[model samples]
Structures are given as structure tokens and as C-alpha cells.
Target chain A: NETAKAELGRATWKLMHTMTLRYPENPTQDHRDALESYFYLTSRLYPCGECAAEFQQLLKKFPPQTSSRRAASLWLCSVHNEVNARLKKPAFDCANLDATYDCGC
Target chain B: NETAKAELGRATWKLMHTMTLRYPENPTQDHRDALESYFYLTSRLYPCGECAAEFQQLLKKFPPQTSSRRAASLWLCSVHNEVNARLKKPAFDCANLDATYDCGC
Candidate 1:
């Protein structure tokens, strides 16, 4: 069902996004099962502004993150945004307290 | 030699903690070069209340985070606090704009 896809997308996205900042390089395939399950949801879904924005933010916040991690975060941020957008809810903010994000750039 | 360990500890601590929130499983072998390089520093260093506090906060904030990630966040937070405390700076806040953290809890 479409609803199932939507729910699965949301769940995986959340997991991926949350893992990214913590395991950036690669989650050592720890989440392969979850990733495999969500393949359909990810493929069915299209990219939107929120996902795009999160991709941009992830790039800004974790420049050294692995491709898998980036993709996961981007995917989650998009779906997270999609559902929230429907409800007209506000965007999520994880603003760092530091002036600089400590990118070591 | 001791000072070098401290510097290494600080750098790796930052890397590990950031990754923990993003990739809560394992950071793969990509950062192994750095992690192995800093093993001596991490082992040589002792935990203080600051590190202990950060560890507690990490547990609170990233309930789904892995032990390794939690340890890294805790170490970074501890050292981060120690440095910030020395400078008399404010706490770092990555507050979400939403009332709920959306942990889906």
C-alpha cells in the first residue's frame, strides 16, 4: 500500500539521518537490513526541496561523511520534510551552539 | 609525548562523536587510520566528570546510538566542556525548532 511505503520511507529516513552525524564514514553495514527494506520506498519517492536542503546541510555540517551516510540523511530529510510539509509543520532545527560547526575546514 | 596524546584525543573525540549521531553503528575502516593512530591517546587519558557528563548527555540525546558512538560523543563533550569551561563560554545548543525532538518516541 502507498501508506505503507510512506511509513517505511519515514522510518528509514529517520534512522539514516540520525546515524549520519554519528557514523558518517560508513555504519559498517550495521543498517544493511533496514536499508534493503526501504529500497522500494526510496526508489518510489522523488526528491523534493526539503531533501535537497538536508543534503545541502549535511554537506555543510559533515563534509567528511561517506556517500552512503549522505544518501541516507538526504533521503530521510526529504521524507521528513514531505510529511511535515503536508501538515504545514515547521522545519527541524539542529543548530549548533558554536559559531563555527567545527568542520576543521 | 603526553601532550601529543591529548591533542590526538581531542581531534579523534570530535570525529567519533559527530559520526556517532550520523552513523550509530560503526564508522567503518575509513577512519581506522585515525582511530588506531589515537588509540594510545585514548588509552592514556583518564575520564573526568566532564567526560562523564557528556557521556550521560549523549545517552539522553541519542538513545539509539551505539556504545562506540556514545563513547566518542562523551569524550568530545567532556573535552569540549573542559576547554569551554576554561574559556568561560556558553553551552552548545542544537535545539530543534520543534517542541518534540521527533525521536518518534
Candidate 2:
């Protein structure tokens, strides 16, 4: 179960980080809305109830930043570091986020 | 790029299917709303622009089914099949969905 949970977390984080990295540099309001709503809804519909609740709390503390691709990606990177801290994982360097994820798109 | 896109697709699908399978058997209206909005927002924010547009079109035609866990999972399976067909991939057997994905949560 722990393995599965960990795998799911990694997969979800991969998708989220890639999405933000690919987000438009100068997004329209609709684009921003979509990204913001996606995260909130993800917190609600995530498979693990406990994890979902924790994410909801995190969102409340640090709402999603959707101003632009860089903002969104960095915001997500910071948030991910918070989760990493809770899990006793090493902090990910937020500075090299662009080099970190490649969606191959 | 194609490899990254395919991997992202696989991860996203795994999370989505797992989440649906774990959905409340008798969900509240709020739960239904969350699931529905998640799909819509996902289509809008998907990293692959072409894939996102295709999904948005599919949503217009099929919409999301959020009445219950069974309904939601089956609906997603069917939608996924639609995608598989377009991509010339083998159709997934939807009969054993509960056995197919395990989040270990």
C-alpha cells in the first residue's frame, strides 16, 4: 500500500509539474481559471482521502499561482517541497524546475 | 517528445481511473460536482494541446457520469476506449476495472 501510494504521488506530481511547465507564458483569464480549478478539484477528487484532505489544507494556506508559466511552475515547485518536507524527503531545488521536468511535448 | 507525451498520458489515466474506482459508492452532490469539474478543467489544462482539444471535443459529445463509483469508472473506461480507438490502440477491457488499478491507499 505504501508503495502504491508513493507511486501515485510521484505520478500525480509528474503530471502536475509538467502541466505547469507547459502552461502559457502569458495566459488568458480562461487559461488561468482552468489551471486554478484543476488543482482545487484535484484536491477534492484525489484517490486517497487522507492525502486529498492534506492537499486541501495546503491549497488553503497557499492558493495556486496562475499568473504565467514561470509563476505557476515555481508555485507548484514550492508546494511540492512542502509535501516533501512532510514526508521527510530532501527538498527539491526550485531554481532548476525547467530542467527538472520534461513532458516531451 | 512522443515518449514523454505517452508517459504523461499513462500516468494521468492511472490517477484518474484509480480515483474513480475509489469514489464514494453513494456520493454527495458536492462529490459529483468535484468529479465533473475536474474532467472539464483537465481537458482545458492538459499539457498536450492537441490531446486537450480532442478531450474537450469528447467531453462535448459524451460528458462525465458522476452518479456513483461504478457509473464514473465505466464512463471513463468508455471514454478512454474512444481515445484508444482514435490512436489505433487496443481497446481496454472495461469489465475488470476494479482489478485493473490499485492505488494502495
Candidate 3:
């Protein structure tokens, strides 16, 4: 169960980071709203209740950054590091994020 | 890139399947709406353009089944098999669904 939870986290993070990386550089208000709402909805519906609660608290503490692709991705990386810190996991180097999540789409 | 894409797909499927598995047995309308909207948003915001398009088409062909947890999971499995068929990947036995996604939450 712990393994499955961890795997779910990894997958959710991958999808989110990739999403921000692909977010339009010059987004319309609609795009920004979609991104923000997506995060809230995700936190609300995430399968893991504890993680979802943690994520909701994270959102309250550090609301989603939706200004641009770089802003959003870095924001997510930092938030992920927050979760990692809580889990006593090693931090990811944020500078290397661009190189890390190429979707090849 | 393809590797990243494939990994993303696997992760997404895992999260989604687990989500349906944990869904309320007698969900309220709000829960069903959230699930349906989540899929739409996922298709709309999926990082991969081609896959997103295909997913959109799939949603049109076979809309999300939100009547019950079992209904949703099986519908998703069938849809996943459809994708696997197109990719020439081996089909997963839907009967083994419960055994596959145990998210020790």
C-alpha cells in the first residue's frame, strides 16, 4: 500500500510538472483559471485522503502559481520539495527540472 | 520523450484506476460530476497533444461511467484496452482489476 501510494504520488507529480512545462507561455485568463482549478480539484479528489489533506494545506499556504510555464513548474518543484521534506526524502534540484520532464509529445 | 510519455501514461492509468476503485459506492451527484470533470480536464490538459486528442475522441465514443465504483473501473479498463489495442500492446485482463491497483492509502 505504501508502494502504491508512492507510485501514485510520482505519477501525479509527473503529470502536473509536465502540464506546467507545457502551459502556454502567454496564457489567457481561462488557461490560468483552468490550471488553478485543476490543482484544487485534484487535491479534493486525490485517492489518498491524508495526502489530499496535506495538499490542500499546501495549497492554502502556497497557492498555485499560474503566471507562466516557468513560474508554474518552479512553484510545483518547490511544493514537491516541501512534501519531500515532510517525508524525509532528498530534495530535487530545481534548476535541473527543465531537463527532467520532457514529454516527447 | 517517448519513454517519458509512456511512463506518464502508466502513472496516469494507475492513479485513475485507483481513484475509481476508492470512489464512494453510492456517490452523490457532486462526486460523479467531479469525476467526469476530472477526466475532461485531464484530456484537455494532458501534456501530449496526440494522446489528448485520442482521449477526447474516446470520451466522445464512450463517455465516463459514473453510476458506481465498479462501473467506472470496468469502463476505464475497457477504454484502456482500447488504447492498448491501438498501440499493439497486450490487453490487460479486466477481471484482475482489484489485484492490480492497491493504493495502500
- List, residue by residue over B8-65, the lDDT tens digit for candidate 3: 8987888889888888888899999988888888888889999999999999999999
Q: What overall lDDT, based on C-alpha atoms, would model 2 receive against the true structure? A: 0.92
Worst 10 residues of 2 chain B by lDDT: B96-105
Runs in model 1 deviating more than 4 A are A1-16, A27-33, A38-67, A93-105, B1-105
Question: What lDDT score goes with residue B99 in model 2?
Answer: 80
Per-residue error (Å), model 1, residue B20: 27
Q: What shift in Å separates residue A81 of candidate 1 from its native position after superposition? A: 0.3
Off by over 4 Å in 2: none
List the DockQ of the predictions in order.
0.02, 0.83, 0.77
What tier of docking accuracy does candidate 3 attain? medium
Give candidate 2's error at residue B92 in angstroms. Answer: 1.1
The DockQ value obtained for model 2 is 0.83
> Among these predicted structures, which one has the highest DockQ?
2
Candidate 3 true-interface contact recovery:
0.76
